[model samples]
Target: MKNNSAMTKIPKGYTTITPWIISRNTARLIDFMKKTFDGEEIARLYNEDGSVGHAEIRIGDAVVMMFDAKKEWPDTPAFLRLYVEDGDAAFRRALQEGATTMTEMTDMFFG
Candidate 1:
């Protein structure tokens, strides 16, 4: 008998994107993603008061994890590492659209 299975095609490197939530505006972040990156919400967990406890979004072929800040994790800032065709252009657009700059776009030895 011949084994015939549909092989799954995968990207060269696939990774999940997780962003920390510190601002009081998790929902606004969701909206920003949709507007900025055309992200679609996949799953969302919310508090009783409608605050987002967690959320998953799919932007293009990548998945992004997001969540609201909890009292327990008071100091963790949202961190995201995204790979795009043009990092400089993306960085500029993000800045033009009001994203708070933690670091300016620079080519590093690691990147």
Candidate 2:
């Protein structure tokens, strides 16, 4: 088989797969990521009207992309599972940061 293109398909320093989150409030989501999991903003591409075209946030070794949703685009919600060093402490921190608990924390085989 021959190569698909001259340039590399995947960008350097990026994984083969990345989760892209579309939200109405991209800035708020980034802020929440920072507060909940110590996510750091890596890159941001903004639109002419000031809306976020695309943005990247890094939480530990994982990188999550985000973009501001517009009226034309279909609204799709994504649920992310993050593995942290301390579950109890992370849960408490999330709650303190205004996250409403859907389920209480408990020890499980799945971790």
Candidate 3:
């Protein structure tokens, strides 16, 4: 791939890809992200029935967008890899927030 950022038109402080979560319990998911990752809530759009239609939370420099899975839409899951100052602590926090890991956390060279 060529480095064409100069020619590409993208929003400031935005990345090419953003993780979006479609969950039945979107409120809990948003709460999890906030408590576990110390995410900052950017904006949230709610449905007339008091369900979240769309929301954005910023963890570090990345903006994670998510919404509730409606009756017409199937559940869509998103897997995200985040870089935090304290990986172990973050993992523990996630576990506290009812998150289960497929495997134990491991250190990577890139991190």
- Model 1 gets an lDDT of 0.69
Among all candidates shown, the one with the greatest TM-score: 3
RMSD of each: 6.1, 2.8, 2.9
Give the per-residue lDDT digits (tens) of candidate 3, residues 54-95: 999899999988888778987676778888899999999999
> By descending TM-score, how would the candidates be arranged?
3, 2, 1
Per-residue accuracy of model 2 over 3-62 as CA lDDT, tens digit each: 767447777767767899999878888988898899999988999988999999999888
lDDT of 1 at 53: 79
Kindly list the per-residue Cα lDDT of model 1 for residues 1-111, writing each as its tens digit. 764342334333335323445655677777777766767888788889777878877777777767777666666665667676777777776766678887667888988
Candidate order by lDDT, decreasing, is 2, 3, 1
Q: Report the C-alpha displacement of residue 99, candidate 1, in angstroms.
A: 1.3
> Higher lDDT: candidate 1 or 2?
2
- Give the runs in model 2 whose Cα sits over 4 Å from its true position: 1-9, 72-74
lDDT (CA) per prediction: 0.69, 0.87, 0.86
How displaced is residue 86 in candidate 1, in Å? 2.3
